[model samples]
Target chain A: MELDFSIEGGDFTQAGQASSRVKKVLKQLGVDAKCIKSIVIALYEAEVNVVAHAYKGQIHIQIDKDKIQTLITDEGPGIPDIAMAMTEGFSTASKKVREMGFGAGMGLPNIKKNTDELKIDSVVGQSTTVSMVNYF
Target chain B: MKVSEIIDQLGLKVIAGEKGLDREISGAYVSDLLSDVMGNAREGQIWITLQVHQNVMAIASLKDLAAVILVKDLEANANTIQHSNEEQIPILSSSLSTFDIAGKLHALLADK
Candidate 1:
């Protein structure tokens, strides 16, 4: 099965809707509880990152018999240093974003911790794409 | 224990999602950081925090949390209350500070 969702940046109200829908689908597919939890967590973090940082984004999901894959691409002020951005306590989110209890710099690390395979690509001034996969 | 019982015992005001008062409470996770709660909180746990944004409800629903307790008498945003009602995950409130409420809740759960 395949799914796609559009993410509007700065729209925190709608941030996790895509993840929630995907979670329901995974549950109905009889995915294991633990597996679903990890997938949802990673997907949600990525979704929120787009809402928090990007101008806009898109999510693509593919689910097969043995695995699930997610690709989130965003147009924004892309990461200048992917390595530094991946660190647990590093973030460039604005003060308003931080005040809402996000911007703690745990977003990427949480995604990494929950997904089996993770890849991140970014161009400093243009865009970023995050791809992650988990085996069932 | 059930969410309703905690509300009664803790004297937490039910802000919204009264339909979910009967939900089971496995435990509690206390934090104001959205990502921290998302990363570490387990399903069926009640979340204690001061965050009043609508995204708090989003995280609560995605995590399948039992309920959300807003400490220090903080009021959730209008949209947050609306989301809580729609999701049926109760939004509870306490005038006590996060530290105090967390301590009380921890002691109560430990007694169970």
Candidate 2:
């Protein structure tokens, strides 16, 4: 099934809702446990990124028999340094995001870990597109 | 050990989904970072965290954690509880801090 979700950056409280819904759909579809874990982790980390860094974004999820692809796009402040952003402890969130127990700089790294193929394209002050693919 | 055993031992209060305590957890992972938990947590484990975010539910569900125990008496919003309910994920609250709860759970499960 091909699933698409629009994520609003209005409230931090609602940040992970889309990922949760995606998880439920994947579960009801009887996706493999390992594949489900991989997709959830990757998708959630990406979702966290959009909430933490971008002003707004959307998550596009496509699932088939052997693989899942997720494209998360954001129209917020892009990364100044993709290399630095990928570092485990580097974060750009304000005091508020930090207070929420996120913005600790683990989001991107976690997404990268869970997927088999990952790509990030960003330009400072433009936008970012993060693509992740997990093969079963 | 079963999650109920840990709860009883620590005197935890179930904020939601009390009936699922019969779940078993062989180990524990404590972290406020959902990413770290996702990267490190193993199956059949209990996650003790101070972070009361919806992502905690996502990470726990992905890992198939036996239960999630929020230490320091922190509270999550309705959305968190709602998502957890749909996923059938049990989230408990404890008056103890993360350190105390982790110690108690680790010691309780270790000897067995």
Candidate 3:
């Protein structure tokens, strides 16, 4: 099965709607409870990244018998250093995003911890694409 | 322990999602950072934090948390309350600071 969701940038109020829907779908499909938790956390952090930093983004989720894959693509001021961005405690979030209890620089690190296979690509001043996969 | 029991014992005020007062609490995770909770908190855990925002509800729901206890008497926003109601994850308030509430909550859950 496949699902796609559009995420609006700077919309903190609606940040996790996509992740919530995907979680329900995973539950209905009888995915393991532990796996569902991992996927939900990873996807949610990705969603928040888009909402907190991107102009806009798209999430594409695909579920197969063997694994679940998520691709998040965002148009924004792309990360100048994917290496630095992947480091925990490194974030460029604005004062407002930080005030909301986010931007602690743990987002990407959390994603990496949850997903089994991860890849991140970015171009300065253009866009970023993150793809993650978790085996069943 | 049930969420309501914690509220009663700790003198917490139910701010929203009254429907979930009976939800069972397995543990407590205290943090003010959204990513910390998102990355580490587990199902059935009661989150103790000072954050009072709509995104907090989103994390609580996605994490399948039993409840959210806001420390220092901080009040959740309208959107936070609305989401709490919709998700049936109770938002609770306490007059104590995070340090006090965390210690109390830890002792309570530990005794269980």
**What TM-score goes with each of the models?**
0.98, 0.88, 0.98
> Would you list the clashing residue pairs of candidate 3?
none
The candidate scoring highest on DockQ is 1
**What ranges in model 1 sit over 4 Å off?**
none
List fnat per candidate, in order: 0.97, 0.56, 0.97
lDDT tens readout by residue for model 1, B9-60: 8989999999999899999999888999999999999999999999999999
Sort candidate 1 into its docking category.
high
In model 3, state the lDDT of residue B48.
91
lDDT of 3 by residue, A56-130 (tens): 999999999889999999999999989999999999999999999899999999999999999999998999999
**Regions more than 4 Å wrong, model 2:** A25-30
Residue-level lDDT of model 1, residues A9-116, one tens digit each, is 999977898889999999999999999999999999999999999999999999999999999999999999999999999999999999999999999999999999
Question: Candidate 2 on A1-136: residue-level lDDT in tens?
Answer: 7888777664565556666777788888888777777777778778777877788898888888877888889998898899999998998888877876778888888887788999999987979999888887
lDDT string, candidate 2, B3-45, tens digits: 7776677898777656567778869888876668877788888
